[model samples]
Target: NKARMSAAGIVGFALEAAPRTTRAQSMDVLSSQANIAGYKAVLVAAHHYQRFMPMLMTAAGTVKAARVLILGAGVAGLQAIATAKRLGAVIEASDVRPAVKEQIESLGGKFLDVPFVTDEEREIAQGVGGYARPMPPDWMRRQAELVHERAKAADIVITTALIPGRQAPVLLKEETVKAMKPGSVVVDLAAAQGGNCPLTVADEVVERHGVTLIGHTNLAGMVAADASALYARNVLDFLKLIIDKEGKLAIDMKDDIVAACLMTKSREPELTS
Candidate 1:
């Protein structure tokens, strides 16, 4: 085991680095982990929530369906929409990407549109590839205004918007949270990235302003069995890029996956604009 570990020499590699290429996507650990995180987030919110997710008809009365609002239409956000839809919640989602409208509505989630003004802002909203780019302060203010209005009507809020190498933008502010209805619940998946909610405390459940804010980091970790299994599979598949068929150490620096993931070999990180 030590021999194989030493052969790869990828121990200190930043496994969380961007997996942009088709080959790299096969070993994308973030997506595997995020799939579970999104599913768990809804369950966690439902458990802590006082009201039922689905509308109920009983001898007594008809209970209204819970309103679920999701921020960001990434893998986790999409999964959260599907999971919540399964539970019969009326879902709404917001994202910077203009095309996310179709993705949200495809899963029965109403897309909250925050229109872009300037040409630069419009270009920025689309981002490089399919990921999110940080919007300028003016555009962000407009988004915050729209999000604040939507949050007030939501019974459960799952915030997943994240900007790489920066703190998660504050979507739900302290004042907004205080004004929400009693018994509302918020699951901030971006807590580890400094949280989309200002009130969130990383890895802690905060009860404030008649609402419960779950700032738990690594929601996938809550279900360790599945999370670890998927993570292990991803890591093992990535190792195949460096290991030979005879099960011997064979470092192939020419391989893109090997070159990007190789940390032991000193190389300057490319941070191009």
Candidate 2:
């Protein structure tokens, strides 16, 4: 298609475009979709779990609030924390990056601090371009140990950990799932790229060791109306960078976003008045 476009003197750009450093975040399609996915993941977990999300006081008895553990403190994970907090769940979140600790607390969720013991571990934990890189095996081992204990106590677990162009990191092991209380729910948002939980079956809701695993890959698609609206706005924002005030197609290589998105340019150039 790119070759055909070039032959036809039509310029083309990548839809999923980002420079090393982004200037305008509003034009980020991935973040927009992820925001919706995060909000919906909590709702999905709430729907599956048999018990109530919030504690209830009644003449019959007192029901305890659900305990939610969120893996990954990215855009999706942070939104999940906010949504769960609004639903009155006791939320605990873990992430490779220590920077997200404040963001987690600001949303009324507890940050499960996994201290970096080694200097190398601390440097890698900083991550790249606002995305988490794969942690060292030793760090992963420690995280898994902490997650195991936490999962046992959690009524609902949502795993959103993923690395770009790589398989999603496994935060929840099969043993941890087995240890969890019966009727607990695990929502794996990284199902498409393997899962944060090893037991997850992509796009399928399954039961393992009395725990419900939701491996839905497209949580944003579940709420299509809002997702589409947000995506459309991202596209609109991106278009403004390439189009001039007089509605002329102005390809500015100086603009980081425009340069980054330029997948193909016309070889047989066509002049526009």
Candidate 3:
């Protein structure tokens, strides 16, 4: 920002983006916002879906619970599993992180096991600080195949996978979507970042292949007050670590948090004595 606009640049995302560190967890805006998004996604899907999430034995007879498949077992994915469980949906989830299997199970969600676990796949999957890096083309092909079968059987699908600085990876292809049952729902939480489904249109719900794809951006908006409160508190907490006692902007480059947040400075430092 110091170049064109001639302004100092320090981004809030410096403390909030992916590849989470333990010390920065309290200040992670991504997780805070994602928690809200995940829960809201399930609710949104339930609203649009033609079926019920929980089984009911009434005068109308028995109703089977909806099948939910959540892609990307990150904080959002985990929360989605938990929320769906609370809603009584039979849930399954998939992610590149091997660690996510345990996480999904802990949330009472079944893990969809993809048979593409090679040494190379494992190495790449163990990305920076438990995040997922891009896998090989062969691995992606296998993942797509697995998703096709699972997505076809799902009544509600929520996709949360995303790659940093790149467009969100497409997990569900158009053909796979076409194969989904009529009246099914797919919520793409990564819609603003180019979506996890090829058919997603950012910030809009579209009907295609007899299914509803919810690609609404900023899903945290559904719970705006709570989401904003959590995100603001995180930003404030991170700012406290960097701001000097005098109250003037004094960035300590020696501090990792400061160094990480600053994108530009006014000018080069004056020579030291």
Taken over the whole model, the C-alpha lDDT of each candidate is 0.85, 0.90, 0.84
Per-model root-mean-square deviation over C-alphas: 4.8, 2.4, 2.6
- lDDT for 207 (candidate 1): 94
Model 2: per-residue lDDT, tens digit, 1-273?
888887787788875666435566888888888989999999999999999999999999999999999999898999999999999999999999999999999999999988899999999999997889988999999999999999999999999998989999889999899899999999999999999888999999999999999999999999999999998998898889888899977777777788778888765433232
List the candidate 1 regions with Cα displacement exceeding 4 Å: 1-11, 266-273
Sorted by lDDT (best first), the order is: 2, 1, 3
Clashing pairs in 3: none
lDDT: the better of candidates 1 and 3 = 1
**lDDT tens per residue, model 1, 1-273:** 434555664344556663566777767888888889999999999999998999999999999999999998888999999999999999999999988889899999999988777899988888774579988999888888888888899999999988877888888998888878899999999999989998899999999899999998979988899999988888888878666799866666677666666555323333121
Q: Against the correct fold, how does model 3 do in TM-score? A: 0.92
Which parts of model 2 have CA positions greater than 4 angstroms off? Answer: 1-10, 20-22, 268-273
* Candidate 2: pairs in clash: none
Better of 2 and 3 by lDDT: 2
